[model samples]
Target: MFVGIIVDIISAINMFTGQVIPARRWMEPFLLHNQSILGSVFYVITYGGRCIQGATATILSFCRVCAVCFPIFYQKLGQPKYIYTMQVLQLFGGGVALVLLWKDEYEYILEDNGLYSVGSDETNADWFYMFVAIMEVFFVVVIVLNNLVTYTMFRLKFNKKNAMKNNGVSPISSQTNQEKQKRESGLDKMTFIVCLVELIYFAYIVYSLQINPYMNKRIFYFFYNILCVIYSTFSAWMLLIVSKPINTELKRMFLIIGGKRLTRSISISVQGSRDNHK
Candidate 1:
């Protein structure tokens, strides 16, 4: 929630600097011509939430896969310094992207004229597009590698379970073995879902920005909104489901509450018994 709030604040600053500030100075040329306040609010809420949620989801999934793939190294990754370093890198990268994107209204150029055809201006735009392409490729590669590692872990766990079962381990003694298999299966399914979603998002974005030159901005906006909302909701739901610690904490809370109620009832009954005896 804190991360999401920070993302929202950052995005709000970006919007204010881009639109509201420019509007105040009568610099209408810098504002998005088609942007209404309603549209802006909708875009910010959806996209801002999506950015934070997506990053959190991806990191959580990566950590799970990492734990299975490299159990020995997982603890090291959780060091405060390392986690802080990662956060700083994420913020820095986002800041750079925003600066580059907002420098001279590059989005307006793309929105109006579609993909650049040819010329110095077109060449510069192409450079930016290619940069985005390279980053997308890198991201997709990481996702693929993560999926592979997780699936390998799943197979290893399955084989281990089979071996244990063949050795006639008691079911009670092997409860953890069974649970591990379930966890692997769930993680495998999650990997597939995440990869599929990422592929679809990349395909849509590439098509909107590069392939379909004649596509309307409204259509692009519609797809972008749908894509982001799906990503955000699915990402959050998956984490909530897969995170055993979260479930355990919830269970612990309930148990504490139940225990207190039982204790109170027992005390009241004891007092009533003493009174009757008296």
Candidate 2:
């Protein structure tokens, strides 16, 4: 997640430089000469970031599955070493995939209108298109399957709880059941949100695929770049929203800031009163 954020930030800067700063005469030469390098950077960051995000989604799905289907083993899965190893492996795989899929020979050229554009070889472009299409399908399928499994687990748990209530389970057991239900409810909501975002992202990928590559409109390119940044950030934003601990910490931070401001205001008012008396 941290890597994805950093990559997205770099992608944003690259987009800004390419789209907004190219008009400046002083920057044109430097920009033109470095366009290919920037293009490669953009390519790696954009696609690599997507791969990272997809891995994150996959990991989350796996954790959700473990929590639901194998709760006993879930505690073992939470070990720091296990998680770190998984992340390291995922990143290594993503990096390798990016290198294999990226077109290193592509060049960026200066347009007559003083803009820099990345030019891809036709063969490489087609390969990238196919790669993205396959990845889109794979991600969509995985997320849908995860959602299905999660929903099934939720239903089973719900029915079991109802059955226990009807059977007049002990008050202690009932209280425990309620607490479990609350936790499961939150988890269900979070999983739903994650699935929803993944579906939206899948649609965006399809849209990009269907659109003709020959259009070459600046607006289209700009919006596409914006979408890429959004794609990288959306999952993290949703995670933060659905995470209780993060939300609580955020509220606490805001309250602290607000308290400081309030104290400053009171001090200023007191000082004004003192001046008036003087």
Candidate 3:
């Protein structure tokens, strides 16, 4: 869930920074072409938003682990409306800050100094990249927590099953060997796939952080942001694929796409059968 929220926040910020920031020319009509104020306002919004969202992801990740490990306690706490509300407030507050900064028309001005370099302080992209780096910290932390929990769950489950079998008191002893194997195999496969996608996301974050410092070169920055876009969208796509409702929708889509010739995947069918049996 932490990763999911991070995915959403980063994607939104990336969209604004990539499309809205560099396209200041198009925004001039909206803000009367006040370039300094525009840059200041957008920079604040982009970076501030990233910071708030990153913090939120860290909190959410901790909450998710607690909930999963202590289901009863989590249930007793009731709904998570307050958490959602806080996220909404973060976004609103960031937006309001941008508006106030823009209204004040704040911008750093240098006196007629000795000289100005090609990439002057006014042209510094580090502010933007600094926020990106901060956001990536959340990504790394959450990824670490997620991988740890997932591996722990797998280890415990595997060990318990093995111990039970060795003691000749297996939980699934009543079931046919083939059925037990199928169920176990499905669980392992699903968990493996989820972990693999997570590793991909972590790799993308690392790649972005490594390249962020060199964003001034047009070709390098262009390709970097392009990768960011792809990673953002693809991560969402992978999560949606695993989401129960979304998976249902995807299967339905495939059925339609295949025009009645496509059968449901074996795992899905088997899971459905177990659900019906229960």
Best by lDDT: 2
lDDT per residue, candidate 3, 112-191, as tens digits?
32111112352344443444555556555674576467457646756676676677864557355445455445544544
Residues 1-278 of candidate 1: C-alpha lDDT, one tens digit per residue: 45644664555454445433433434444344533443334333433333444454456567778788778878888799878865664454344344433332222333333321122244544555565555555556677777777788779878987898999999886887777667666667767888888788768757765788457754665566566556645745775687566667878999999999999999999999999999
Candidate 1 whole-model C-alpha lDDT, 0 to 1: 0.59
Model 1 pairs whose backbones collide: none
For each candidate, what is the lDDT? Answer: 0.59, 0.68, 0.50
Model 3, stretches more than 4 Å misplaced? 1-41, 52-60, 76-135, 165-220, 243-245, 253-278
> In model 2, what is the error at residue 30, expressed in angstroms?
2.6
Report per-prediction Cα RMSD to one decimal: 8.1, 4.0, 11.5
Q: Sorted on lDDT, highest at the top, how do the candidates line up?
A: 2, 1, 3
In model 3, what lDDT does residue 271 have?
89
Backbone clash numbers for all candidates listed: 0, 0, 0
Quality of model 2 by C-alpha lDDT? 0.68
In angstroms, how far off is 220's CA in candidate 3? 5.5
C-alpha TM-scores of all predictions: 0.65, 0.75, 0.51
lDDT of 2 by residue, 1-278 (tens): 56656655665675666555653334665766676765666566556666666666776687778888889988888699877976874575358546754556445444445464554666675666667667767877887798789879888988988897988999888888877776667667877767776777777666665555554445556666666666656666865666666678899999999999999999999999999999
